[model samples]
Structure formats: C-alpha cells, structure tokens
Target chain A: MSEGLTFHFNVDGEDFTSAGQASVMMKKNLRQLGLPPEIIRRVSVAMYEGEINMVIHAGGGVADVNVTENYVEIILTDSGPGIKDIEQAMQEGFSTATDSIRSLGFGAGMGLPNMKRYSDYMHIDSEVGKGTTITMRVNIN
Target chain B: MTVKELAETDIFSPVTLPCGGREISGVYIGDLLSWVMGRASSGQAWITIMSNVNILAVASLADTSCIILAEGVTLEQEIIDTAREKEINILKSEKSIYDIAVFLSKII
Candidate 1:
C-alpha cells in the first residue's frame, strides 16, 4: 500500500441512528488496506465511540482518518457546546446525556473511556462555548 | 453451533442470516451499547433487548457471530435490510434475555 492514506467524513448529528457511519467506512477502508485485525478493531471501536459522542453531545462534526506506516490516527472536530470538564468527562460513569439518549442504549458515560481504552494514545481539546477536538492514534505494530 | 444451526431451532427466529454459517463461539447479554461493544468478544452471539441501527454498528465493531434480539424484539424492515447488506447475522426470540442466555448456555 501507499505510505499514507486519508479518509474524511461529515458526521450527521441530526439522526442519532445514523452515527458511526464514518467509523464503519474507516473500518472497511482499513480492511482493504490489509491492516492487522486487532489494529483495525481498535481503530473501529475508538472511532465509533468518538462518532457517538459527536452525535449525542456535539451538534455534528468532521472526522478525518489518517493511515500512515506506523499508526492509524483519527481526528474528530465539532462546533458544539464544548465539554465543561475533561476530567469528569473522562470518568467512566459521568455523563450529561439526556434520558432519551439513555433509552437508546447509549449515553452510558463510557464513550470517552472506551475511546481511551481502545486507542493507544488519545488527546482532547475543548472550549466550553466554542468547540472540541479529539485526536486518537492506534499503532500498527 | 453455527448461527444458521441455532436459527433452525424453534426457540429462535432468524431475523437476518447474512452470515449464517459463522460459528458462534459464545454468548454475551447486554443492552448498553458501549458496554457490549467493549465486552463482547469476536465470534460470540450477543443477546440484547435494544434493537436499533446502532445495534448493527456495535455488532459489526465487536465482530460478533450474530445478534439475538430477545424478548420478542425486532427491527424495522429498513434496519433489517441494512443488517442484511452489512452481513450481520441477526436472530429473534420471544423468550426473555435471561431465558435465552440460559438456553444458549446449554447448547453453546
């Protein structure tokens, strides 16, 4: 395969049901490139959780996946009400999702934690009223 | 048992069997999407009361052999169609989640 490849998508926050499309597509693309199964799974789970967070919390967002020789990187950005507390948000059982989101079987306060769990490295940048940017990387080795 | 073999039995109905021949290594029961996504192992059959498009995404991410919709749960035709296209084996049962898990424990 080439040294580097990229995929970009616009996550639709309007329909909660439609979230994760970007992750699925990224999984397929990574599969086609013949990446290791475990790496692909890690990337998929991390990206899926990030996508769900964007849908439930952020109004919507843009996701960019960069596949390089060393690792796969995912960057998700949104112009939604930013996270007020990164520390609390990282806690496994803390969440601000509404009851409706809970009924849908999501908003369980595991999104950020799961993302961190699956990806080898993760970073979050947010402004309370401005926006949020999340970057995660899963190594190929 | 394979997904198709399990579906052939009367206890569960096949909602979609796009990957019927896949072997079901084990069974996982949970309704929380993130919990299931993190815990469910590949080749296992995930049982849940939650039926939605998101379920399909979780199943795919977890690489489960199939999804068992217990307690008579179902998906809309559109979602079922999507499951088929995604090659995600899905089954349904009128039994409760606990009962289905019990049944699977005896067989899987």
Candidate 2:
C-alpha cells in the first residue's frame, strides 16, 4: 500500500444541511484503508468538528485530509469573518454563534475543544479580517 | 435485542429500516449533537428531539444502531430520504425521552 493518500473537499457555506459530508466520506475512506477503529473515530470526530466550525463561523471552507502510515492530517481553511479571539473560542462554553445556530443543536462552544480532544496534534492560524486555517492530526498508534 | 424487535414494540415506530435487523447494544439520550458525537458508542440507540439533517452526521460518525425521534418529532422528507440513502436506521416515538430511556433500559 502507498504511504500516504490525500482527499480534498469544497465545503458549501450556503447550505447548513450539507455540513459534515466531507467527514462522512473521510470515515469511509479510512475504513477502506484498513485503519484501526479508534484511529478512524478520532480522525472523523476531529474533522467533523472542524467542518461544522467552518460552516457555522467561516461561511464554508475547504477541507484537505492526508493519510499516512503513522498519522492522519486534516486541514480546514475558510475565508469568512476571521476569529477575533482564538483564546476565547477555545473555551468549552464560549461561542460566538447566534441563537439561530444554537437552535440547530450546534454552537455549544465545544467544537474547537472537541477537535483538540480527539486529535493528537492541532494548530490554528487566523487573522481578524482575512480568514482561518486549522490543522489537526491524529496518530495511528 | 435487534433493532427490528425494538421497532416492533408499541413504544417505537419504524421510520427507516437501515438498521432494521441490527443488534441494540445500549442507549444514549441527548439533543446536543457534539455531546452525542463524543459519547455515543457503536450499536447503541440515540434518542433526541432534534430532527435536522445533522442528526444523520452524528449517527453515521458514531455508528449508532438507530436514532429515535422522541416526543412525536416529525422530520422533513428530505431528512428521511437522506437517512434511507445513508443506510441509517431511524425510529419515531410519541413517548418522552425519559420514557424511552426507561423502556430501553428494561429491554437492552
């Protein structure tokens, strides 16, 4: 088998109904690649959270996943309004999502925290007006 | 018990058979998708009142046995069609989340 595989997706920010589609596909790809269940779950959860965040805060974005021998890497990029405070955003209960978003059962302020919780490594790069790009990795071991 | 048996019970009404014959392992009740995503285990039935398409995402990622829409929550046809397409089992119930949990506890 190859040492690595990459998958790219264009997330549509206009439709909330279609969020997480990328993560679902990624899960299937990981399963087909014969990854361990635990590793697959972690990668899926982290990627799913990032996908949701992209839709909720960034008005959609791009997701790229690279799977290698020892780890799975997820990179999400969005051009929506950038985060004003990354520190506050990382808190478990601090969300900037509106009430409408909350009614959809998201905006719990848990997305970033949960992503970090599931992934072995995570990094966030953002500017106030430009956009944000998050990178997360889950180790196979 | 299998999901088929649970759906056959008076408490549950089968909406989609994607998990018709799958075995039931346990139950987790919550409306918060993130919480459910983090806590739900494979083969367990997830109970929630939120009927949006996001439920499908959580159910698929968690690999749940079935999703029970408690309190007579009706879902849109699009959601149902998606569930069918995704091969996700969905059940509807007129009972409260608490009642459904109690019933599931007794059975599985």
Q: Please give, for every candidate in the order listed, the TM-score of chain B alone compared with the true chain B.
A: 0.98, 0.97
* Model 1 C-alpha lDDT per residue in residues A28-137, reported as the tens digit of each score: 99999999888988999999999999999987899999999999999999999999999999999898999999999998889999999999999999998999999999
* DockQ score of the complex predicted as candidate 1: 0.84
- Candidate 1 per-residue lDDT, tens place, B25-103, comes to 9988899999898888889999999987899999998889999999888789999999999999999999988889888
Off by over 4 Å in 1: A1-3
Worst 10 residues of 2 chain A by lDDT: A1-10
Model 1 chain A worst lDDT run, 10 consecutive residues:
A1-10
**Candidate 2 per-residue lDDT over residues A6-64, each given as its tens digit:** 99999988899999999999999999999998888888888999999999988899999
Best by DockQ: 1
Candidate 1 to native Cα RMSD, angstroms: 1.1
Each candidate's chain A: what TM-score?
Answer: 0.97, 0.97
CAPRI quality band, candidate 1:
high
